[model samples]
Target chain A: MPTWSRRSPPGWSWPMAEKKMVDVFSDVERETAMTANPAGYAVTELGAEDERIVTLAADMSNTVAEFIAKFPERYIECGIAETNSVSLAAGLASAGLIPYIYSMSPFGMLKTCEQWRTDVDYNHLPVRLVGRLSGLAMGYFGTSHYAVEDIAIARTMNNTVVLSPGDAASCVSLMRSTASLEVPVYIRIAEAVSRVYDEAPDYEFGKWPRLRTGSDVTLIGHGMGLGLCAAAAEALYEHDSIEADVFDAAYLRPYDETALLASAAKTGHVLTVEEHSVAGGLGSLVAEAIARAGLSVRLGQVALPDKDLEVGVPADLYEYYGLTPSNVAAKARSLVRR
Target chain B: MPADITLERGRALTEAELLRRADWVRLQTIDLIAQAGLGHYSSTFSCAELVATLYYHALRLRPAEPNWPDRDRFLLGKGHVATGLWPVLADLGYYPHDWLKQFGKVGSPLNDHPNMKLAHGIDFSSGSLGHNLSVGAGMALAARLTGRDYRTFVLTGDGELQEGQVWEAAMAASHYKLGNLVAIIDANGFSGAGPTSQAMNIEPLAKRFEAFGWTVREIDGHHAPVLLRTFDELPDPASEEPVAIIARTRKGHGVEFMEKQPQAWHLGLLNAEQYADVVAEISARMELANG
Candidate 1:
């Protein structure tokens, strides 16, 4: 009943406080961990449970097909025929079997886009679209292979739910749930496995989970970028007095309205981070929500440029675009001081 | 000649009725296109008899229950001729005849192409060429998976063969040996810009399908009895391979003015005098059959 304050004391902590600590999970760690790339192990586990879950790859199996070989009958080796593979998967989806259509991000999502839209989305059919190497994960593969515009295009569709899971556990949970989903789901799979949540990490579709809470600044990131945000938050606390609240938005299309509002209200300053183009990534969605809700938060966007990214490794590109922890921490410091 | 039948039924379609309906379907397509200001009339006219044969006699479908699991599926891969499909569907009681009255109107479900979500009796939305064949392949596979005896039919324009996805499905169908699936290619010489031979010519059409492990057949598209006989006697999906029926057709079969003229392929409007000529011509053909 006390007067509410953005910087409320410890007594004001919500139920989410008990679930805030990051538990260590070692099932699918790739030497390093981040908040992005939740789908790696879950995709593998879902493949283990269901024999009908097939993964079709267009020459890229290293980064995305880890789970495919576990169930051979559930995988098809279609070399470079993106359109045919998509159409065939759509056909297979009709057979009551879930088919995960996988390929590189740009080639998979944009190359056979028309076929995907026609065969999968328009049909309102449940065909899992997996963009294996999302965003700048192609590294030296250059601008031609980078899938920076996927979120925007996928958002325009009717029955297609776009997902950018930020850890292995979330990815596995979402993949398993997609079996019963009536609509199409597009998962942008990051090249590296970032973080592993605790065994009891309850995941929900279209809902954002708050990892860290602070009153000074709110940091929002999705998919692979979420790890960067989490890393940046830790850096900010060590170097500067600013405490930032970090939220992981797994579903890109339907943003979590309640989490977005609460975060925006808590901190007048909000920053969105993504590996996709700044034009239509999480930044655009958060900004739109802020404007709609009539909230007066100063929104800062951190995403790749609208133009094609230069050739480099995923880490180099992430650093080049100030997507690394130190760079994000510096950007947050500058914005908070302003 | 009368269509081959079980003898007691006499014919799949009376020769006179076949001739009259084929002509009617052709002219009606032209009229609808002209009225709607859009259609693939040339392609529609070419496949008129084949479509008429299926609707009037061959396909075991119930218009009342379009989603009946046991009902046979007829998927039109070349969906530009949605104008032609409307009347045939209406005649078959798939929809009311008055539904065509709103063709091309704003917000009307009856667009230039068929959309499964927007329109009833349409199993799949097509227009992005070569898609329906794969969808039909899936439907055929679904029948097998569900243990249903229903067969699946897909019609693709010969020009649409240029799409590589079609060949992919063609290969899949052959490899899976989907004999319950019959793909009919309306081999009209002309396409959108000009004659297909002048565009990207693909000849020996039936041979190409055969190489893909399909049971292929070539037939005169204008001949209704031949089409009826083949459709009625189609093999089961358990056959060694899928089936492809290549229908050799002229661009515009009944309408002399539009015949072979690709420009007239889908003119959705005809002046009063032109309309009169079409009506008179159809009247004469009907009278000749009656006499």
Candidate 2:
């Protein structure tokens, strides 16, 4: 029975310790911070130029305190009610405002999924949805909070653009790109990622961003898995003498069929990586597209198992789910050697 | 006229004129529904006078520009009621009357529910029950944030209250002090299954809204003048609360043989006998009111 104050002993906060562990991967994690999450922040940045930019959140304004500090009027905290937060955002869009809604991934996307599909997607309103700590990032919190199937559910909706930025830099870039889209966009974020890609190539909303080039095998990763994929590819060259191609399918819904087809043609073997469940996720989408196009490529997926996850540190969970560099590297080696 | 049920002097219209307009809208809805051979005609017929009063004398709107930011937003939560909504939109000049001829047709914007894309005057797409109230609250909140005078009004079916999400939104609307948002529950005592009371009694509906911190009003929904006045005279939400007016109405209000008949809850190809009965009843009421 201890009070949760900032003055508490060093190890008082589990989330704080969790933050430290994620920092070890800071080299790559920092590359994927969210661009337009907590709609309050994104709207303030865009509202200066576009009067239509507005934001609504599910009583989580304190998480994006800086945005609220800067633009109090634009931020709305619906006090822990995710359903109202979504419905309100739809209403704002109907009133001619570009609305962005922010909430935890599970509640914001899954819990209010029907509202998202019927109210926003069906209407094709420019309502931006930002989901934080997606996938197993909420590992310690258990099933109710984890957004493991967000990508799978969102991809099924028509006229929806799903973005999973690998690092903070890409998060910001993707945010600015998808902000002006006429249709709804779902942006999944994993804060403080480690890998930072070179900013030389311009980022496109629906096009996959290539982080590393290789001819022997193709490693596909979305959102937080990009760094692991890159590390895995590098390890393949160092230990096994196989040059693996690392492609970031930043946008999950509109899978880059052309890039995927071309890479499959070059490598002949494809491996998709993500922190989401294997069922109906990025891997399934890729496999379906490759099969449809009649492409002769061996497709493989490295993903979290479909079940309720146990509580633990994020790194431990990531490692357990075969998302770490070592596991990813091993998977790549086996695929290329096969 | 009860002084309390009087509309603003300038906007008020004779009950005969309102009833005539409502009847015309009803005829248009019947034609469209019959042509489509599928619709929520019974539910829509029940709300005709209420919608007519609001558009003509209550809500501030611009049919020419449906997306006018300053315009008042009207959300139809009872989506099954869309079958009747088509003609009302046309009568308001939101679209041509001919457009409704394509109701339920493939590629026609007019589906069973109101779609802002296919037609004008609808603020949001609502066929899924218990969603429009929150959207209206959002519009009202947006008005407050932007410092606009526009208000938001939502009309939902009594059965839709069964959704837990509706109460969730009801609580949020009151918490935000959305005085600019007004909810009108069409308590016609019927739902998809049967009588709303039998399905689930929502008695003391006004008290339920009042308990959630809303200004409450109960009135006969078919009375145009009373309906218009209720909208006009809505209390300032009595200390920043939202407003809810429980509209007491019959499931099939205008047409005889359909009213209070659970079997007539939703009409199918109106048989010659039933159609003749409805036509005779409406003609008699139209004459009595006209006289």
The clash count of every prediction, one per candidate, is: 13, 15
For each candidate, the alpha-carbon lDDT, in order, equals 0.76, 0.78
Instruction: Write model 2 residue lDDT over A94-170, tens digit each, in one string.
Output: 77778878778888789989999999999898898888767867666677778889888999999899988887667
**Candidate 1 regions with alpha-carbon error over 4 angstroms:** A1-55, A59-77, A94-97, A292-294, B1-11
C-alpha lDDT of candidate 2 relative to the true structure: 0.78
| Residues B189-231 of candidate 2: C-alpha lDDT, one tens digit per residue | 8887787778778777888898999888889999877876787
Best-performing candidate as measured by DockQ? 2
lDDT of 2 at A56: 72
Error of 1 at A167 (Å): 1.0
All candidates: CA RMSD (Å): 12.0, 5.5
Q: What is the DockQ of each candidate?
A: 0.34, 0.70
Q: Model 1 Cα displacement at B261 (Å)?
A: 2.4
